[model samples]
Target: MCDAAETRPGIDPDRLSFTIALQTAADQIVNASNITGSDRGIAKAVLADPLPARRPRISARKVKCPMSRYGTTPHETRPLTSRSLTHLDITVLAAAEQPAVLPPSPANTDRRSRVFRLLAAADPGQDWTARQIADALEIGHLRSLSAQMGQWITQKFLVREGRGRYRLHPQWAKTPGDSLDSTTTIPA
Candidate 1:
């Protein structure tokens, strides 16, 4: 029975109806105690019916919409309609064309420097929680700020007043523009 269901050379096994019949037979044999004689007869009858032919695989790719229908060709030019421009429109266009003046970047704009400046500018006695400092500096993640704070504590740049709270070290608690050392300092 297994030899009769064997796929011939160059023939696809999935296209053979005997493959499905063999699988059903194997299943019935494995559950022999559960499957009754009537169940076996029903399986035989179902397998006797002719199987539908499998459709050939489609090789062409499908597109949402054809490009030619909606798009214009390189040679196609849209007709320009001439209209008088109002005084307000001319003023608005001129203003938009002019380059916007942006504020100059701070000299010490690094994360550590910014944190140092913010903490030093505050009251020396005040203790800032991580959340408050993050909110003030617009920092998204507390973990990053916490890690930086840890490093600062080790460097003696910041002092941890309590849990989740930190303040600038007493030695570094000077006004902005006052130099702490030659290496690290708050910019004016």
Candidate 2:
């Protein structure tokens, strides 16, 4: 029977054999002239009862290490939080609206500088998503740019406007020829 099933298209021999074995075992147990009447009754009850309906199994391929800077695990939807902007946030937003000159010389060559220059040169009140910045800078990997953006945020070179949106920090919105070092502070 299993050999015939194997020759047929879309039929698995192993599955057919297992089903036959299971049915034979069940028949033997239920029909056996066993010693215990209780065991027979239990087996009859189980056989008579319909099996519960089962959900179909689903399979998905998932990455072990997600490239996103936001979270370690993959998520279908991310929760958006709403909060009132603080004094500093408002100041940064207002300052970000002002146009600033790009840093000179070798500063334009590095990844960080290129990002800063793009954000700095953006039109008033314009913010950039990681993908947008990556596209603008011709960066191949948005994840790499996002990671660098996170670092820039920590270094006070950029301010996060909203989820995945970034703008130049108010502190760094200075005139031309100023040192681009993260440590240097301009007095308000």
The sequence of per-residue lDDT tens digits that candidate 1 reaches over residues 1-188 is 22322323333233446656766767767777436455443245333553565674333223347773323334434333333546553344444576888989766777788788788778888999989999999999999989988988998888998998899998888865675443675433
Residue 51, candidate 2: alpha-carbon lDDT: 44
- Global lDDT of model 2: 0.60
What TM-score does each of the candidates earn? Answer: 0.41, 0.37
lDDT of 2 by residue, 1-188 (tens): 43344334543232344444456457767777444553443333333342444443233323356773323224434333334546563344444566777767552467777676666666636888999988888999889889988988888888999999888898666456554454443232
Candidate 1 wrong stretches, greater than 4 Å: 1-106, 175-188
Task: State residue 70's C-alpha deviation in candidate 1, in Å.
Answer: 60
Deviation from native of the Cα of residue 140 in model 1, angstroms: 1.7
lDDT of 1: 0.66
